[model samples]
Target: MVSKVNSQTKPRSRFRSRNKLSIKEIFMWLIIIVLFVGMLKVTTLLAKTYQENQHPDSEVYGVWQEKDVAPYAAEQLIFTQDGVVFEGGVIDTNFYFDGKYLEYQHGDTLRRFKFLNKDLTEMKMLLSSGYQPVFQMSEKFQNNIR
Candidate 1:
């Protein structure tokens, strides 16, 4: 009976040891995880770069003057031909021209805006502020149009 017990115990110990993780296996798994994370980062950067390269809408590109009840641009609110929008000369990196809505990114704070009206001459945007500022096309822009 004692010999039988010893044999059973020896096999159980051998099974448990086989199940244990080897050092080489652990290192291999860590390397795989690191590579996967790196690939994801690279893919995200490429996607963003591609998006930034796409041209903006002709209607959305220009200087705008701010006004009350305005749906869009002005000297106060502006979109450059590049994928850049700024209020005045202070360029805010948190803006984008999506062809539909001006995607404004205010970090952590959520704000809603609406395009009340838009045309070649004027743009009225319902800003986060209670009053809507109307942006008229710049005089320089008008002169250039002719």
Candidate 2:
């Protein structure tokens, strides 16, 4: 003969009852997920756009130098009919021509120039020591000089 335990005499559980989520919580979660996806898509598009804009094929004309053209330093000038000109202390000087401008840095100085109609339209010269003038000539002007 076992005695039966009464349900009312049993100790109540200490754990709190979890309330069901309301409509507001469900909507908020949906909105959060949507926003997260939207943000991801936007970031991906922006990255693709940035990458696409990074490389372009175009003509560039200018003079550049890897290091300062000291009076005694050996230098070479290279001109291409495609409107690219390279001038530097050494032929191996690391140089690159962007479609619209020429960029060169030596020591703490950075120089940039933009060409228009084969003539320099803008020259940005920043240096800690001396001045270097890079020139651009139109094909007509070059032929006339010759």
lDDT (CA) per prediction: 0.57, 0.46
Q: Please, what is the TM-score per model?
A: 0.54, 0.29
lDDT of 2 by residue, 1-146 (tens): 13345543343332323356778999999999999999999999987566446622223223323234464563333333333233433322443455456555444555554544333433333445576454433222242132
Query: What lDDT, from 0 to 1, does candidate 2 have?
Result: 0.46
Cα error, candidate 2, residue 132 (Å): 44
| lDDT tens digits, residue span 13-101, model 1 | 89999998999999999999999999999999987677666623445555656655334432355554433345434344446543335
So what's the TM-score on candidate 1? Answer: 0.54
lDDT of 1: 0.57
Regions of model 1 farther than 4 Å from truth: 55-59, 65-75, 81-87, 91-94, 98-101, 104-146
